[model samples]
Target: MSAYVVVELTVKNAVAKDLYSAAAGPIIREFGGEFIAGGAWSALAGVQGHPQGAIIRFPNRDSALGWYNSAAYQATLANRDARMTCSFRLIGN
Candidate 1:
């Protein structure tokens, strides 16, 4: 089964998020994460949802979790915190 990182963000600093996303992309890719969806939203229809979001799919839950917990990503987290408030989850089915 595939796993996904569902990210819900409220951006206060668009510039920072943009930079962070660009930097984070390669790291995510290294862990086999592919960006499937991103951007502002009209609604959140599921449980534990938010208005602005993105989804990155990985081959499995472990891959997704590894990417999320990796040191490279941790180093980049400050930029995300500077730009937005986010709620995230790793989900699989």
Candidate 2:
């Protein structure tokens, strides 16, 4: 089974967000995860949750959870508070 991390976010500081993304990418890869899709979005129906979003795919639920809880990823998130407002959900299939 595969797992995904779906993120809905609105960036407040582009510089900080870029920095965070750069720093987090390698750590995600190290844990067997890769970003499958991301970018601006439009609402076709229902409530528009956020202006931007991304989906990260992992080999399995354990890999997804491992990346999220890893020390390196946690460090990257330390400065994200001033960069964006976001929500992350984990799903498996």
Candidate 3:
């Protein structure tokens, strides 16, 4: 089965968040995740008022979890935490 990581983010500091985004891409790719979409979006139906949403698809749940838990990704994620308000979910399919 495949998996997807869905993230809702509100960036507090764009300049700092960009650093996380750039460094995080390679880590995601290493774990077989592909970027689906990311950036500002209008809340049309669910979860109103948030301006940012991101989705990434992975080969499977294990890969998704591995990526998130890996040392390299964890390091990058710290920057994200500092620069943004966000919620994340990993969905299995």
- State which candidate has the highest lDDT: 2
Provide TM-scores for the models.
0.89, 0.94, 0.89
Off by over 4 Å in 2: none
lDDT of 3 by residue, 1-93 (tens): 989999888999999888888899999999999999988887667756557989999999999999999999888766889999898899996
lDDT of each: 0.88, 0.91, 0.89
Q: Give all candidate RMSDs, comma-separated.
A: 2.0, 1.0, 1.5
Candidates sorted on TM-score, descending = 2, 1, 3
Summarize candidate 1's per-residue lDDT along 1-93 as a digit string, tens digits.
999998998888788778988999999999999999998776646554555899999999999889889999999888888888998888895
lDDT of 2 by residue, 17-68 (tens): 9988998899999999999999987789999898999999999999999999
Model 1 spans with C-alpha error above 4 angstroms? 44-50
Best by TM-score: 2
Candidate 3 colliding pairs: none
Ordered list by lDDT, greatest first: 2, 3, 1
lDDT of 2 at 27: 94
